[model samples]
Target: MVTPGPTSPMSPAAWAGRRDARNLRAPVKKSRRPRLRRKQPLQPLNTSPLPGDSGVCDLFESPPSSGSDGADSPAARGCSHAPGAAQQLAQLDLQTFRDYGQSCYAFCKAREGHFHPRESLALQPQVTAESRCKLLSWLIPVHRQFGLSFESLCLTVNTLDRFLITTPVAADCFQLLGVTSLLIACKQVEVHPPRVKQLLALCCGAFSRQQLCNLECIVLHKLHFSLGAPTISFFLEHFTHARVEARQAEVSEALEAQALARGVAELSLADYAFTSYTPSLLAICCLALADRMLQLPRPMDLSLGGHPEEALQDCLGKLQLLVAINGTSLTHMLPLQIREKCCLSPSLK
Candidate 1:
């Protein structure tokens, strides 16, 4: 009991040697639970509830089912579907649309001449307006069949005219040019353009794939890759959107008005007579005519300058006659497409 009772403290070197010996003897076993090297700093408990805090988070809450008819649900409000959402958003901001429409009209007016082909400067013998019209008439059904957009059709015609004006294309190659321009336009504007085979079939295989490709290259080169020019259809759409907002039209009614206006604009596109008229002027005329046909409110208050009421009336008269003539031909040629898209008979009449 007395042994080592009063042992003096060991020197530093001796204590270190004893610790090293103990350490070399065997590895120490660790506890199953991990031990922190240092105690964690003490933190005060949060006794108060968070602002706007509920018992549980919304992340844990179940979402409304797609089939649910709840008014607050996104699906029920038509926001889940792309097309419906687009339409809903389009109709939401009517208050600022008037200013937007005016700006579009003004910009189109300023750059109107730039959009037209060089009519006065004759580089070579070009296709006649009648030939152009015939080619476009054929292209329409093809465009409709492929489900291409109206903008695509407009761009195709633009590409055709710009190419013809700059390059000397023979009458034999006119159809080839038309199809090629359409191909270029489709690729530019469409999400899923008609393939080469489909385009050849549309042409009744009159032109080979190599020929089509060659013509597309030629057109692109001649036009200098300038595809940004706004067509009458572009201005027409802007005016129609503005008119729809101005009149507070129902979606169906707005669509009807747009169809009528587009029908008139398309007539202008087919006839070379409208080449003299600016796209802005054509848009104004189409909108005015559509408004009258739909028995909707007049867009007369819109800022249509650079021409008198008489001039607009005269242009509208010409547009009406062209629509009548084209409507007849359209009925005979692509009757179903025309009827379905333009509602030509009732609207034009």
Candidate 2:
């Protein structure tokens, strides 16, 4: 008897809203389209008087209603229609970011390529599986707890690996730099950038903004400012969406099975399973595996106990192979301490 997790009913109105994507409940007249609305910046949540209140503006501002003076606004006069203004601004910011990143990459490349090519240019004299495991052991828990998506974490790890493969910072500085690079990658990928202070706070003040900036420079110099590594979020999203859609025809239990399958797929992505496959292909495989597993007589629940145990075990196997391929250690993926606490032994009964 599997206890199902909370599920939100797919309401007709919600389904229709997803399809049309229009907010017609509060009707807007055609006259509003032509007039320009003033864009208001969101006020801070702290500014609000009510408890539990968050002051945030609507994603898109409503346009002003058109009257006899409709054409007189700045928007109507083409002030807001600059073709490349947004692009130009974005490019300028990217240039600045790239400049810092390239500087870091170049520094590392120069050190590894020229200064000490044969001197074990690895940030450490040696990075054994054990040491790698120890590092990831610390990193993974922190990352997951912070809600750092799997894909972003993968990119961070891969980026560090690529940089290390080329240029070796000292072992003492490696973790500091790795975390900084991860922070930068998160900022690049996530909608919200975790602030420097927030990260420093997490590290118990072991590192500072200046230190992070300096290390970031070195990493950028080594990698030539390349931040093009792939992430797992893309695959996770696609696979989850497809699984949800495919299971729509099934009974509620079947849907739960498939949804659980999707969760297993996501957890399986914990290791570098996504590295070999293109993002799209990885997405497909994850979905396929999830679908197959869910269609069983005793469907794998992906929950903490009972039938979900099998699905969880399956995910562990796949993740292990992926970690091996990427030359990463399993300390972060699954630690002995965690296994003991969860009562998950090698036998996995």
Candidate 3:
């Protein structure tokens, strides 16, 4: 059921074409820009820590009462708010992690659906599919700017969607929610999370530090502190390693294909349609399509993932449509060598 893969000649390009596109969230910086908040950095919440627990603050606090002071907020501290104690993970070193990688993948896959939201926007009275896309477009560039890993991006979207599913949000507060989700996701996987102020600065200071801190607590509470979700990034890396170990494809070829697949996966993040598919399924389909696109020799054994063929085909077909639509952006996102050789498969056209 898969459509013909777009044969993108890869090259030095990486997310090149899209950065210039107007950020739905860039802070106004010129005379044409405003020192004031309008759309970029719109206001969201206010924060103050709950009483006690001085070693670390509560990951969440009840909304401030009319009688309370707002002194313990992230703004009050002048630093990135560390995710409260609840989000901390036990130390698992790289060698130890690799030794138990498969078991870890199993644990993550089992919990993916528990953390994932089905038709998340169906609950939103204000946010729409288009709005979600716009928000993600801006987020992609922001994440790249921050030099965050792809795993963080996946978890960020998961946190965003799941929180939206459980809460009713205002259109005005949606942008704040987006950054708040990113912050929470960063805490999960990033060693040096972006400062609350840095994120707000990108939004052009439309959102205050307090509002972001407040929302962080709300998201953590709403999701019940379940942050370790499976991601396409994890599965993509997993399948790529398996391909190399099986000696099904040359390391160079597999790496190139994996790079292209990552761009595809990033595009998928903005797309709500792909959300219902599990990370493992999407990762396999992406690997399959990448092989076809890069035309890698001795392609990966898809059976290793153990997903049904029909499900693979269905996801592959939709991903083809997505690649076709974003063919130019995808090309620009690839390295220069591949960019020159790459062409969208005729079938996609």
Candidate 4:
């Protein structure tokens, strides 16, 4: 739901470093659903529509159905029938898809590449260099399709990547999951969520919105609503503020560092590389990349420009940790575990 919306966007000058307008991380989970808390004064900068805001589609509108189409869900098709039966059905589906391709989505896949799987973090590439070729194959064309405002698309990709970090999806299902996640994200962020039928019509003629919605629900359930995070735009704000306040060598260094950080994050999209990592890790990667680019050998010293060193350091440290955890051993960790030492697994629980 959207409200009248705030006329004034926060200016970068107001909060240097950590509290900079651009650096404001999107509130995850409950914070995203707006409400007035007596303890927290309303910041004029908070402009996003509340989850229950008016003028948006009513929540009561029929949630997409799973049985509208004759075809069963990927789960049902994958397991309810026999092994060979699923493969046979998949072949039939693919053939049908070939006959009914829609131009809505531009198909992307590298002609040559490999998927490197680590022991605990099974499907992630160890380094961007090793994964660049394949990642470019998917990212280049896709980025072309979704331009600068593509942060939402990136969010969707990040969601899929994060889900893949702990959940073991089959290699074959990767495209399906990625596309479906995009569909889900579009529904959430876009003024008009594309019809589920449009996506299916592009992939294969036989499917329906209901089946896609079911798959989306399955994916959402698996991810446990952890996909949303403050985006690069948030970082850009803090960086802008830092640049505004710095002078002389410090100013040059800060700008260089911020640019470098952004470059690193841009590189992340190549392989959906940031997916396995935590939010904190992703933030670190952005900073570290910037740090290295600025030729700063040590962690950023926010005090260089009289910025709130404590808050800046705290935020940066947390962000860097997120990036480090993403591609490393920590990629295997989940948000919260539940019942019987089980993960509250997405599907097989």
Give me the candidate number with maximum lDDT.
3
Q: What TM-score goes with each of the models?
A: 0.64, 0.44, 0.71, 0.39
In order, the Cα lDDT scores of the candidates are 0.67, 0.47, 0.77, 0.44
lDDT string, candidate 2, 82-183, tens digits: 112222222223334344644543343344322211212234566543455556556665565555655566666656666666764665666686578678
Best by TM-score: 3
Evaluate residue 279 in candidate 3 and report its C-alpha lDDT on the 0 to 100 scale: 87
- Backbone clash total for model 3 is 23
List the candidate 4 regions with Cα displacement exceeding 4 Å.
Answer: 1-120, 123-140, 148-150, 192-210, 245-263, 271-349
Q: Write the per-residue lDDT of candidate 4 for residues 1-349, one digit (tens) a residue.
A: 8879667865676546546666777878755667767997767643444476573544345333433353343334322211122332222223333454222111211110111122323554442333433533454344334322344555665555556665766544555665687776666665555566655655555455676667788878877765544455333434334333432225434444444454445445543334433332343446544553334545454443233446455545544443453433112211111111211112111
Comparing 2 with 3 on lDDT, the higher-scoring candidate is 3
The candidate, 1 or 2, that scores higher on lDDT is 1
Tell me the lDDT of candidate 3.
Answer: 0.77
RMSD values, in order shown: 12.0, 29.3, 31.7, 31.7
> Which of the two, 3 or 4, has more lDDT?
3
Better of 1 and 4 by lDDT: 1
State residue 319's C-alpha deviation in candidate 1, in Å. 0.9
| Tens-digit lDDT track of model 3 for 227-338 | 8888898888777666665667765666667767888998999998988898888888888887778766576677888889889889999999999999988876666656
Tens-digit lDDT track of model 1 for 179-271:
888889888888777788978887687889999988877777777787777777667656656656666565555555555666677777888
Clashes of each: 0, 12, 23, 18
- Measured on C-alpha atoms, candidate 2 has an lDDT of 0.47
